[model samples]
Target: MAEKNYYDILGVKKDASDADIKKRYRKLVRQFHPDVSDDPDADNKIAEINNAYETIRDKDKRAEYDAMLDNPFASQGGAGGFGGQSAGGQSGFRWEDMKDQFGDGEAFGGGGFRFDDIFSAFGRGARGSAGAQSSGTSGGFDQFGGGFGAQDSKGQDQHAEISVDLASVYSGDDYSIKLNVPVRKPNGSVDYENKTLKIKIPKGITDGKQIRLAGQGAAGHGGGKNGDLFLKVKITHSDNIRLEGADVYQTLNIAPWEAALGDKVNVTTPTGTLGVSIPKNSKSGSNLRLKGKGIPAKHTGDLYLTLNIVNPEVNTDEAKQAYEQLKQAFADTSIHR
Candidate 1:
């Protein structure tokens, strides 16, 4: 079988811009994300897409991979050409094949051979005798092609989005999300563990704010500290209401008579229920601002009630007669004029 092309996987051209690649990756993620996608192969597709994006998105990695594609045996010396045979005398050796054979370096033992080891090996010059070419103090491929990192490093941070209810933002609440989190086993192999995390939604947290959970991301390698998980908040509100920062706007329907004659009516808002007085001869689309009733925060926001006049159906004789009287009483009032 032929090797899969990263560009083909992401559906982008070789010369695609960074923004274009990002947009394509996001689109593919939305299509294959396990939570929302109905595709049976969503999990595998997502993994493949991630691997492709991770490789090509980086300059060094992309250049290294391009070298492999252009000429698998371009590099001279002990490391070989990454094809046919490697410095370790392994035939048909390649990073992707090795990843399939030993996942997360678990096959060899804990902290054995990781997928990232490929980058550490091929992305840089081969270390000469006496470790002359080694760049970092700890982590890199040794002269003998052994993958080792003397120093433990912190894991990469992970990001996700969470939908927060507007009401919950008004009054703090708890939320839960199930994630296929990566777990580092004793054997050094990484596997996904299905776990639920409880998140505390702080009051007055605006949209696009982030909540950080420590030690919730990928496990650190070689006993390094685990990375933090960041959750971007997305405030969700009902169709009748629109939220803008700390301010809340809601549509309040009122009877035509109440709008014209002015009256006190009870209204249910995000904060609570209150009796609001309608000014005499109120018109549709007029706003009634309630002081400091918006989302609760350090700087409180105001809630605006937009009036919408609704006419009653004149089905009964009494109602029809009332409408007839109202029409006659307002007959002289030319609304268009």
Candidate 2:
């Protein structure tokens, strides 16, 4: 069989840009993640996406994989992989004929199976002078080119990115997430198992920080402890709010008169709406600070309101006359400061 195409798995073309690939990958992760999704195949789907992403995300790895995709013998294990034995049959030893001769535990000791045993059994010499590379019982390939099963080996830790909106960060609530894990079959094949977990998102959490779940990663080979799952938080922000650490900034638009004469106005904050006083003769771009009003945590953050003065349109004659008078009054005034 041909090796799977990483690009196709992510629903992207070979020419897709890095940004485009990231967009698609994020969408798929959210779709198949077991903690939040209801689909039974979500775990397998996500695992596929993760594998594709890890392979194609690197420039050198992608180039190497692309070259392999064009090669005829790429899947047959290249030079070292058994690749199902159809290629090695030209020398009178058909790989298909050995189906009844070898079993997993029949040839090798308790460590693991080796492909070299097959070559030795047939007296055709080993696959290579180096012999079959043993992966201990933990992870190396078998002599017949089979892959490692769980074998009680500790599962590997898995990583994923989770995107959260600003509201969730402010609330610091517990969230449920879903994921699919790989389960090794008796025949050495692997299958996906979906799982969901309730996790707590730390309040005042910043982007790029990670939260860890114990025993939530890939299953161990046999009775080995499951690996941990680490989630890197990606906080998605909107144009309406700018968040930095505990500091929150928002641009507040106000009438010109309000800035010149001053007034108490209600301002919306991450916590809630609060009435704040605008100082008299305030200029546009003035900052109104509300201490300890941004995010609620051990160390509270402040909210900074940037004032933007807006002049009303002079469409009516009365408004035009008022503007003309104001212009005349200030025309000779030395307000250059």
Candidate 3:
């Protein structure tokens, strides 16, 4: 197969800036990510994007790739590549065919042949001599004739969920969040590492929304580009308030006397405590709306106060007398029955 151009794969110019490369990479990732895309080649496309982004995102690796693109035969692991036989060697052996003949043919005890093992089989002196030629020159081919390009420094971007309190969502504050991201090495092994980041919570941010942080993810390989961090916001229930869209709701308890007569009572809102007027003859379960006092947004919503009437203790002589007087006043009324 022919080598692919990293810049073309990422839809960027050869001289594209790091930020431009990242933007294009993210757009492609979203389109080709396996979890979201059902394209037959989505996985392959993602890998290609990752590889290309890794190569071009770094100055050194990109320069090396550009050099290799100018001259394909400049890399180590010779021109025929990967599974071909070395020229002028005895036994008419191909690396893949040799792997089939010997159970230990693969690199590092696998069925495949390792480049280093192939070099060792040819003798260390021969390998050293090959390296000496390729080491100093910009386009000199190595023993394997494959490119010895630098890896990407910025690793793959990872996604995770972050939990935020309702207060934080309502008030819009900065929160410290910790996440465990998976790091994969070039050899295909994976490990988890913990990272703490401070994220700014935007006001009126709904649950299940996603926030993106650039270059705050895993380290890249071979000096490639670093990955991005995605934070999915989740809000827990609050004790004082209930969230409904951009609106907030709470219940306020009022004394029987206060409910019957008009009064100004202190009510708590998400922003602060404020006094609200209850009209005379205000019945239990009355809802009072405090305008523009709810969650912060371009245009604020109202805070609702549902009134719950509470009866005073009748243990006191004055309270008992007042109740008796009220009862006597309604003695002729059949409404109680």
Candidate 4:
């Protein structure tokens, strides 16, 4: 196959900024990743892009490539020629003679250049003396000497979802949670290990919020810092109560007589059951507000009770006869409706 231009593959200019290069790289990688793409040649294209990027992204390699473009044999023969063969393969030159001519110094007065040093820097292989093959094989950026300090004993971070009842968020408390954390051995092998961690749920924590646990993530290599654990909180619905903002709400079923004639009724709250007085002639759907009776927070919210009128189920003959008598008494009264 013909050599491909890295800049063309990435759709970037030769003089593109690092940021632009990275942006283009991410876009192309996402598009051509074999696992995520159905394109028949995606894998081959991705590999080509990788190689192209490796050559152009490096300052030294880019300069060398540019020089080669200017003079195909510049490094091989003319103008301070290094006795090395041009990648074009005209003929091999004496590398030692070029080294002597250039002197054992950093590239152009910068860091002194050593062929072995450059190879090692780029993660090719450990430097060997002249004529010795470097032992390490190249593996993309992972081979770069100063990349990640060590391999992760555990491959990747694990995630989990945690459900909290609405009441718990309203009135914060300590919770004990169990999680399966990936543990790695010294040899960089991983296994799922169950761990119990106690977390404090802050008062007024909202639903769908997240909590981070430091150093509770997957194990790192060579005793490196562990990854972080993220806990996503979901509020569960309750049968007895509904939550709105910071307030608690519930429907109170009351007998028709109790609603019409003022009466004391029992209502349940997070704290405890309390007696509530209903006004006389109260209508169904009338809301009663209890101040500071809702969530336990720094600024407490109120609880609301919506009254619901309920009629007793009459199944006996006597109950039916009494209902008939009541209907007859109110037969002419439009107020009953």
Candidate 5:
């Protein structure tokens, strides 16, 4: 079978301009983005799109790829292919040299845009597999996608992102994930099996930190050890909360009188509910720092309460009169200098 064409994958013509290519790429990405797409193969489609765009988007790489397409036999030697002799009865090319170029899946850079970036853009995490191969040519399929040869080699490691709730980070919790993993059959054939594994989220685990699972990645060949799986943690929080390292900032709503006169109010925090005092004459957007009340790490972190004053509606006559009286009281106070 012929190799997949990059242009066909991106739905673009060979003579298409850069702008056209970029526009097509964006359209395809939106159509196949896992978050919104209903396609079952959206994940694989995205990987193919990213790989094709990364190559064709670059001028130098595109030129090199075009040359290869124009002369398909140049790299494999004129007429001489992998088997034994050339099509023009010349000679067989060196299999070792071809293996050096395409084997081990490093030739194409393993998909430039990683899966983590795709899912992170949607404010979530993703689980998927790529280039997962088994040891040996079990099912008559070689590790390099050809029927040429087989050898004992360790499988490649896999990476994915996992979303962890802020509450879960405050207190460690257990989570489970399902994946389609390679299972090496006793007959030496490789089979993809759905498996579930439970993961532990440690307390105070920050975003971008990875958790490694041994022997949970692609299966190895010829008694080689299986590759490990790495899960990068992404800490997720509500819109009202923002985190800066170990410090947590949350919006605290208070009344107008509470801001003018000191008052105590209860706040429901990640740790628990606590009564906090609203300082007298406090303004909106003021931060109240509670030391060592953020994430419960070794050093601990601080929690900041940003005050947001909200006013009650003055629809009732009594309410309107009260507001009028208050307005008269503060009429002489200059808000702006």
Candidate 6:
């Protein structure tokens, strides 16, 4: 077997740039990955793809390979030709003969051509045996091709975090978040691209909890399905409220009189304003619990309101006089208590 045309095996031209070759190589990998593909020749096809990519992935080696492609007698020593030591005076090089330089399952880079690299473009970096999803990122991009047959193995799952406002979490509405996505460049380097993906946020989602959106993650090659997308919910700080385990905590400020004489005060919450009644003789640090008003969830959360009494300034003579009279009314022991 004479040296197979690396370019032709990858379905590209000899003059094709590394970028062009990589583009074709990935497409072919998707179609022929043994774990996903049932093609009888998938393994052989992928091996060839890996072999071709290995030779060309390296700049110097590709140059030498290119020279040989142009003229079989180009290399120094005309070493055994490419196909192997010509027996019976048979001449010329074949790529398969070069396999001797490296063992099976390894590429020219001292590494194996991994399905991970290919799937990384689709956003999954790790996979379980037989292509089952182990772990990965949210999304990815690459330079390449069309469709493929269904995968024999399932697609890998992807993970990401999206920050959501407290109000949005309270309402459990659909949220759109931006991701600074890492993409594989034509030269096989990494670069970033901003992607805006719309994923449904589950109602009553809590902070630090992950929401799984199926089939919205890393895309699958061939007939394989895209992996699942897991968005970890990160609740942003609210101007007036703090959240904890689905509970909403807020501090309510009331006038001294309101605390002493009991008052119906209107309080504002993320949902809306409500008139809450304060009990007579209510002191600071007192908490008022509103049932089922915290986060909207299956278990339901409660809103806890803590009251703080604010005193009127004694800047005016009349205010000072009023304070004196109020102070005197309460005996020393009562005041101390």
- 1-337: candidate 3 lDDT, tens digit per residue: 1143567677888778899899998899788776678897765676667666666675775776666455533333221211112221232223444445555434555646676565565433443232323233211233333334333235767688888877677788898877776565554223467877888999888767788898777766534456788888877765646777667778888987788788998876666779889888888787888887776666677788888888888998998999999889779978633
The runs of at least 3 residues in candidate 2 whose Cα sits more than 4 Å from the true structure, single-residue gaps closed, are 1-151, 186-188, 335-337
In candidate 6 the C-alpha lDDT for residue 329 amounts to 82
Give the range where candidate 2 is weakest over 10 consecutive residues by summed lDDT.
Answer: 78-87
Global lDDT of each candidate:
0.70, 0.64, 0.63, 0.60, 0.67, 0.61
* Error at 274, model 3, angstroms: 0.7
lDDT of 1 by residue, 1-337 (tens): 0134677778898889889998999899788777688988776676556556655666765666566556543223212222212232332234445555667445467665654654555443442211223343221234423222212335557899999988899899999999888765543334678989999999999889899999998776545678789999999888889988888999999999899999999999889898999999999999999989999888999999999999988889999999999889989997774
Candidate that scores best on TM-score: 1
TM-score of each: 0.60, 0.53, 0.50, 0.53, 0.56, 0.51
lDDT at 209, model 4:
66
Badly placed stretches (over 4 Å) of model 4 are 1-158, 165-171, 297-299, 335-337
Write model 2 residue lDDT over 1-337, tens digit each, in one string: 1234567678899889889988999898778777678987765666556546655665764665566555543333322122212223232223334433554424445455555564555343434322222322211233322221213345557898888876788888778888887664443234678888888889888767899888888665335566789999987776768877777888888988889889999977667778989999999988889888776656788889989998999899999999999899789878665
Q: List, residue by residue over 209-262, the lDDT tens digit for candidate 5.
A: 899999898776445568799999988888889888778999999999999998
**Candidate 4 lDDT, tens digit per residue, 37-88?**
8888775665555445545555665665555446532333321111111221
Global Cα RMSD, each model:
11.7, 11.4, 16.1, 11.1, 14.6, 16.0
- On lDDT, the candidate that comes out on top is 1
Candidate 6: TM-score? Answer: 0.51
